[model samples]
Target: MPLMSDGDEKVDGFFRLGTSSGRFNMFDRFASLGVKWTGAVNGRPEDEFGLAVVTASTSPDYRRSSAAQRTESVAEITYRAPLSPWLTVQPNLQYVHNPGADPTIRDAWVVGLRFAIGSRLID
Candidate 1:
């Protein structure tokens, strides 16, 4: 929720955890933690900085049947900046370790860009 707030500036954190029965799900356990800061960059309230890590465990049944590794994890860093009131762009960098939980596969670095657009129907 709201971790800290100073006038129009703020910081927030989040966590997520999940589990499955291991019957039909590919992953039996999953977790993620993240934090975001607003208005911390050059006094731009619309700009945001974020960091997060996520991990998942392959279900026992699925690992046994598919010969998959036990776990996969990723760490990511990102920044979101607004181009206008209704449009924003986010650039992110990620390091994926044990992707798909396959030992034969190599860990990799990934870069991505995302664009978000929003508008008010009526105001």
Candidate 2:
């Protein structure tokens, strides 16, 4: 549930936890927490901005064989804007620490884009 809102502008926060059942999985535990803000941009209510942090722990069973680091963490920032009623574009940036949970690999900065398309079934 959203914690606060004023018209189309709002702030929301969330947390998630997950676990894998099998021993063969690369990750045994996952957790994330984040907050997002949505509001009018150029008088359009569809624009949104978000920031988040995430972490994952390597499974003990998998780590024993690979000698991998215990955990990986990431910090992310993103924005979403509408290109049209049915299309939207999102640009994202992330800093990954301990990429793949391997200390030998350098931390990395990643940039990416996402596109979303949707339509109503009955107009």
Candidate 3:
């Protein structure tokens, strides 16, 4: 549940324990945690802004196969601004660490943009 929120604004999270590897998977017997926040931005309650962080660990299988890297992490920050009632534009930034549980592979930084449209149906 969202423990932090002011009406429309909310924060939520999750915890997971499982496997990520079997036939060439990255993490085996893996564990992960993630959090997400959804709220308004720039005094635009009708618009949207969000931030999320997620992290994971490599399982013993991965460790046995590759010991150099054992953890993975990613963070995403994004904002959406409304250009019309049904149209909006969003921009995003993301950083990743220990991608694919391979220390030899460099961590990554990414940026992107998205466009969205919403519709309401009446019957």
Q: State which candidate, 2 or 3, has the greater lDDT.
A: 2
Question: TM-score per candidate, in order?
Answer: 0.91, 0.89, 0.68
Model 1 TM-score relative to the real fold: 0.91
Cα lDDT for residue 48, candidate 3? 57
Please list the residue runs of candidate 2 whose C-alpha ends up more than 4 Å from where it truly belongs after superposition: 40-42, 120-123
C-alpha root-mean-square deviation, each candidate: 1.8, 2.1, 3.5
Tens-place lDDT digits, model 3, residues 6-123? 8766766777667556447655555555555565553565665666666777766657865657678888887777777777899999999888768788989989998887783222
* Superior by lDDT: candidate 1 or candidate 2: 1
Model 3, residue 21: C-alpha shift (Å): 6.1
Candidate 3, run of 10 with poorest lDDT: 34-43
Candidate 2: residue pairs that collide: none
Worst 10-residue lDDT window, candidate 2: 114-123
Q: Give the per-residue lDDT digits (tens) of candidate 1, residues 1-123.
A: 789999768899999999999999888999999999998876688899999999999999998898788999999999999987778899999999999888889999999999988784234
* lDDT-sorted candidate list, best first: 1, 2, 3
The residue-level lDDT of candidate 1 at 96 comes to: 98
